[model samples]
Target: MKYLKNSTDTNYSMFLTNPEVICRKIGNGFFLLSSKKTWDKCPYVQQISETGAFYWNLLEKGIQRDEMLDCFLREYNIMREEASEDLDYYIDMLIEYHYLTKIE
Candidate 1:
């Protein structure tokens, strides 16, 4: 939790801010679709893993990185470093693809 504030300029402080993205669940996974205006810029539809879907659900509700870590700890028996690393990669992917916006 202490890292939450200290990590402001780091990836760990970012939160999802995109609202024009759409996600639909299909067979225990989910597919993300961006609005038509955004589609031309980022054309690929993203298919996410179950864990990624969980993260996406949290993002849709405007969750923060520490909250993601908390959820990971509660749901999985993983180390904090591992959870943080994975979350960073996942969030980076979403942000890179325009699926999730990073809040400053």
Candidate 2:
């Protein structure tokens, strides 16, 4: 499975509007607000779960999956197999959606 790595702090910029994180059940989608740009134009906006948002934030800090998995294992107390499966699923989804670029 492919994954992201080595992301730098420079890669991400904060949303100026401090966008409200809202989940829309109708479309099963997430949206954000932008204070820095025009209504139709904004930064790279994407819909992701709260957990995914957490991991994405960590990725911006250059955290790797191994480290994330360690944290997840400790926090969730789940089996390694289960954790690996879930991580792989999320990574695959991110890559498929073009939100993540595979390094190698």
Candidate 3:
């Protein structure tokens, strides 16, 4: 796991989908598959939970990081700190796997 980036930069809306990644709805969750161009980077299929699908859609639509935090808290029975931490980690993993690109 990478160190969480809980920065205060208001401009950091964070990860959006990478061009070569495909998101497909599967039941209540989602499947993340790397395109041919990204096969060398991350070739495995990623199965995500329904909660992850929610965030994935949000990020795909360019939702702000703060809004993401609020959504997590409102939708799940978790503390704000836990939501923030978990979201940060999920965003980090998406980037690591080439499924998402961090907006500069």
Top candidate (TM-score):
1
Model 3 agreement with the true structure over 1-104: per-residue lDDT tens digits: 11112344544344557767767896766888777887888756899877777887777766667776787778889888877877777877887887776556
> How far does residue 20 in candidate 2 sit from its true spot (Å)?
17
Q: Residue 21 of candidate 2: its Cα lDDT?
A: 24
lDDT of 2 by residue, 4-86 (tens): 33223223322111232222323655533234333344334566665665555554455667676776777676798877677
Instruction: Give the lowest summed-lDDT range of ten residues in model 2.
Output: 14-23
Local distance difference test values of all predictions, in order: 0.68, 0.50, 0.70
Candidate 3, which ten residues in sequence have the lowest lDDT sum? 1-10
Report the CA-based lDDT of candidate 1 relative to the real structure.
0.68
The window of 10 residues in a row where model 1 has the poorest summed lDDT is: 1-10
TM-score, cand. 2 vs. native: 0.52
Residue-level lDDT of model 1, residues 1-104, one tens digit each, is 11222132545454544567777797776888667778755645778777887877777766666886798789988899887888878877876887765555
